[model samples]
Target: GQAASSLGSDGSGYGLAKALKHSVTCIVPALVQLKVKAHPFAKASGVRTEAKVTALIDGKEAASDTGEVQITAYGISGIPVFQISRFIALGLHQKKRSEVLLDLLPEYSEDEVYRLLVKMGDKRDDLTAKGWLTGIFNQKLVPRILEMAGVRIQTRVSELRKSQLQAVAKKCKRIILPIQDTNGFENAQVCAGGVRTKEVCPRTMESLRTKGVYITGELLDVDGICGGFNLQWAWATGCIAGKASVMRKKK
Candidate 1:
């Protein structure tokens, strides 16, 4: 805000524009990843796997994606996590709580997971509960799953009660972890908030609030996800603003 306003972007000349208080109109962690206060039972050193990730704000789904979620000691990364980071960043900016729900077994329904567990229980009663799941789910995930379900890792599957199996099934399908914040602006590939787009002319990229001033690219309140959308934005807006400014000079 300071950087743009310093260049007279705060509508200094337009009597129609008042000197306004600055606030984030959208987000800051666009194309970045989220940081989390991962549950102790859900912590992983550096594991990578595919899952259906849902980011929530105040218990409502704000964003979701299905892909690789890289679990670090601190929190999650990878593209799927990046896809939802903007929502989390915005939620945090508004002082609202955010969360992430991971479906490690995206292909299976909750009931199907329970049935599979029962079938495995019938055949692998001799193996420990953790061992039984190790063959089915990722070995790296068994400990965390069992831990999340409140089951002891070494308990024999034969010793497992019906309720415990149900609990385990639920955890596998929906492991919800609270998000603390984003990885911060330094880690963002591109940012989302700047000059308000409503204050600029769409055709010319000139500031409606202050004539002859053009705001474009990351300088405006626009951003995009991965795969060069942001790159295209920068180029297109720069061209429009540049051309308009030149045409005005000729006039």
Candidate 2:
């Protein structure tokens, strides 16, 4: 007996296998790549791009750069900072910028971050701080570290100066926004651009555009964020489409 099979998806065919002559819908998971940008230290000089920074003077935007500041590294869906860092790093090709500006750290208020750094300085030796910083930061740049930590000048500490603080502030004020590649299927766990859902009947996974044709799984332009959602979508849609296709033969 001859058997007819409808292809929903394969491990890697979700994107390329949309060539079915019948009424077809494609399900591509949304693939998001980490945006990449140059590290702060990688800049040739102090030329400033107006858009890249929050310009926080006292937890508020500086007078020069205006508009709302975006904070990254904040939790997504109740995920903690440590966990979010993992994703961010993965997106960034494991190349985390060594100098993260203070404003980017959303967990602490501006004042609290400065006080914490001061306290850290008090408890630890400055040489030890420099040594410790060298490990995590690029080029052993102390001023940049201080600026990232939101530390300015301390009258009590004779070693730190106003000019060095200003330099650090300038360098640490901005981070380049990462650029995402047009296609992220290679790195993405799920593909994004699929058949537009509007064309498919949600109830039966049948093509509203073409009669009696069915679509299901990752072929129907349905994708969800990480978790079991994509799998669930595949299971549910596949079942509905399969049942509908079978029932159509009897009619």
Candidate 3:
């Protein structure tokens, strides 16, 4: 966000500029990084879960991830979401329709979900429609799911109709949200593309096509997920390039 811009993402891109001048080829990844944004679907935020999340481009599943899914004010973020974010970014880059489907009750079968909802709906208690699913989902998500199922929060769970329970079951298994855009480079963990790797000597980090010039860090066509490899690559290559420059100067 604001923090990223302050870190000198001023958009001058001097590294890529220099690479361009040197005529080094660069293969940009389909995306840099993404914690995608989407149109508002849920009435609440701060929802988190570990389940199956799939990114669909043009109504087809391109990528899916499972682990943690964090619901942000803008859309979604997390390692699992991040895993499939490339497809989201790629689809958007190509102007294709992009959507993300969440299986809130992934571990349970559709029939199991329906049976559970029916069981909960029959229970008479202080639990309102909002809290009916509290035993099944995060408290914040309960209302969101009910809202998606077209139920009022104040409605009593015991009064839930069979059709309403079925709708809830369907939503529990599949919640499709239309993606709008990603949080952009500023929020990305690491850029996916840079100068082509083959253009530089691996050991010296010096440009093979343009001697006396060196490339390092994001300037090289290398990127890693959330692992420290991205930072390590930047550090290691920068050190190699620095040493190569020193040696040339001494000669």
What lDDT score belongs to each candidate, Candidate 1 first?
A: 0.77, 0.41, 0.72
Q: What is the per-residue lDDT of model 3 for residues 63-155, given as tens digits with 9 covering 90 to 100?
A: 887787777766777787777776787687788998888898788987899998777667476668876788677887776778789989888
**True lDDT of residue 51, candidate 2:** 28
Cα miss at 69, model 3 (Å)?
3.0
lDDT of 1 by residue, 58-142 (tens): 9999989998888877788888888887888888888887999999889999999999988887966578987888767667778
Clashes of each: 0, 14, 0
Q: TM-scores across all candidates?
A: 0.86, 0.51, 0.76
Please report the candidate that would top TM-score against the real structure: 1
Best by lDDT: 1
TM-score of 2: 0.51
Give the least accurate 10-residue stretch of model 1, judged by summed lDDT.
9-18
